[model samples]
Target: MERVRITDDGFTTLFSTEFNQYYHSVRGALDETQRVYIELGLLAKMQETNEINILEIGFGTGLNALVTALEAQKNNLTVQYTTLEPFPISEEDVSSLNYQTGAETDLLQKLHHVKWHENIEISPNFSLQKVNCTLQEFKTSQLFDVVYYDAFAPSSQPELWTVETFTHVASFLKKGGFLTTYCSKTVVRRAMEQAGFKVEKHIGIWGKREVVRAIKL
Candidate 1:
């Protein structure tokens, strides 16, 4: 059975039964996401253009998408976010995730309830399309300004950490687009580099020491 696991940062994340791991860092779910995907990936792209198109590999708990939507509304930026998830969390579990209260909680509800494969505008600045498929099965001619490579760890899903998978995902990026992930393992970094990215290591807090933001030049 699945359950909610509270991280060290007071926020809660779910333990994936299929993957047998926590969705986000055990130290802090919200903190880790804000640091990695938002800071290293989305915000960097936003500095260049107010309009952004984001491609996320996993829609696990919708935290990444929720945070992105909040940022877009706050900055008055336009965002088109697409996420891929093969096995979505059930509604009961989604409601149980204690991220925040009031409007933030409501926003999270909107994110989970939005119909899949159809673009829905959550706010004036943010639009989302959730695809219920794994990255290997995802197909689209569209390219994105940035990618949030928030998949399970290499230990949980080794197949996804290979050069071939990185190369396949790279095709989803537009020219100059970069992919940011919470993993900076030597083997993973090498795979990303071999897949044609200029990988850079960023200092990370919590359990992991470093994260990576790889650019496709």
Candidate 2:
């Protein structure tokens, strides 16, 4: 079963009993995502090109995609977002968490309800494809400019965090692409490095002292 959890900043996150994990850090879901994925991952990529392709490892509650769509509209940048989720959360669990109000709630609903494996325009500037498969199982011709490595923690799902998996995930990125994650573990950084990324660590907003940001140059 999954339940809604309120973080320190008052935004909501999902806690999974099956994995005994929270979808995001308990410190704050919105704040952490904005700082890690949006600022470090997407906006950093936007500095180089207006049109970008993004690949995400986990869809979870679709919060990352939701905020990225909003950013795309806000900055008037074009974004192609592809996300992989082996198991989607239930609709009841999705409705329980309130990330935004008014039209954005509807936007979130659309993100959740959209059909898997089909590219659909979510807004004028943002298009999305939700793939119902694991990162290991996902095969695509698309190359992404940035990757949001939001899989469950290594402790919970060690398989997803392995060196072999990172290599496959790295293959999905175009040259000079970025892969950002909320984890700063040495083993994680080493895996990314071995997978052909130039790794760096930056101070994070919550959950840990620093996070990993890898470039595919």
Candidate 3:
């Protein structure tokens, strides 16, 4: 079972008693996604091409995908977003989220309502394909331009942070593609480097001191 907690930054986040962790930062969930994933990962590459392909490591509450979809619609950018999640949250939890306001709540609902394992056009420019599987079990011939590495923390799920896993995930990226994550540990950076990514640390959001952006060079 999951519970909701209002963080210091005035946003609601899901707390998983199973993992003993929150799905997003305790400071703020919406702010974190916008700062780390949309601003740094998606918008940074928006000017380079009109169409962008994005892969998210953990779909979780679909917050990252929702913001990306809104941005895509706003900027008239075409986006192909593919996300992987082994276990999805319940609809009750999704409905209880306080992320959006007024009419925007409808958009959030539609995001979660879309069926998995098939491509769904969220808007004229944004398309989503939610894969109901873990990264270890996910396989695809398609290459992505950006990867949102939003998995659980290394302390909780150490296996997902291994060099072999990063290398395998990196194989799905096109040349010059980048992966961003909230983790900035030296060991995690080194693992990304060993997996053939040129790693760089950037100022993090809210509670985090720094984040990493790794490029496939």
TM-score of 2: 0.96
- Model 3 misplaced regions, further than 4 Å: 206-208
Q: Model 1: per-residue lDDT, tens digit, 1-217?
A: 4478888888888988888888988888999989899999888998899999999999989899988988888888999999998889999888878865565668888899999999999888999999999888989999999999999999999999999999998888987898999999999999998999999999886545899899997
- After superposing candidate 2, which stretches have Cα over 4 Å from the reference? 206-208
lDDT (0 to 1) per candidate? 0.89, 0.89, 0.89
Estimate TM-scores for all models: 0.96, 0.96, 0.96
Give the per-residue lDDT of model 2 (tens digit) for 1-217: 4377788889899988878899988898999899899999999989999999999999998889999999999899999999999989998988887876575658888899899989999888999999999888899888899999998899999898878998998887998999999988999888888889899999899545798789986
Clash pairs (backbone) in predicted model 2: none
Error of 1 at 194 (Å): 1.0
lDDT of 2: 0.89
Model 3 misses residue 23 by how many Å? 0.5
Q: Please identify model 1 stretches exceeding 4 Å from their true place.
A: 206-208
